[model samples]
Target: MALNDVEEAHVEDREGNRYFVYEHLAQGSPTVTNPTGKETYRHSLAATTVRPDRKGTPYLYTLNLSCRQDLWDDLQPLFKESIDSYRLVPTTSNYIAPDVRPWQFW
Candidate 1:
């Protein structure tokens, strides 16, 4: 792939652990009948060991991933349903509502 097509970045965590983020897509895009018919996004991130003698600090590891915005939106409902079916949220009989009108003065 050409250098201009990809985006490279790096970030450091609070603990001083640096992470390298590399993002790229397979290609510019596939031709579609309708210009706005499809939309997609892809990216990759990675962390790796840094050289001690290196001028700049380096991350210890790396990661990679790709995404298609339109495709993601279309599949989001199913994903949400799957999570909902998992019963991730607990049911409560007694509800403790937050104070909205005013706070209690001591």
Candidate 2:
């Protein structure tokens, strides 16, 4: 998929429920979070919770992302701002970006 349209979501077992988080990969090969794919994986897990199949309940964390190139240039900063913007209600975390080589992934 294109850079501005690269979205990744993952689910992890934590606590006693399922969590979800996401990340948005931008285009122009701009400096973004390294392992953003995995980064999103963890992020998605942190967002929500998952119920356990056994006697113990499990919390889930989801790392979901939005593929938007408009913030590609300033993914880190924008990510932070976006979190703050959304956290206005109760969330306590935001997004962080690192530099990575896209071509190397291939």
CA lDDT of each candidate? 0.37, 0.37
- TM-score for predicted model 2 compared with the true structure: 0.26
- Tens digit of lDDT per residue, candidate 2, span 7-106? 5556544433334544544433323665434323211101443433233544233333333344445554555454323311222243211123324411
Worst 10 residues of 1 by lDDT: 82-91
Tens digit per residue, CA lDDT, model 1, 1-106? 5422545455444234343434444432544634542333433333333322123442232233334544545654654344223211221553222232225311
- Choose the strongest candidate by TM-score: 1
Where in model 2 is the C-alpha error above 4 Å? 1-6, 24-68, 77-106
* Model 1 CA deviation exceeding 4 Å by range: 1-4, 28-42, 45-60, 68-106
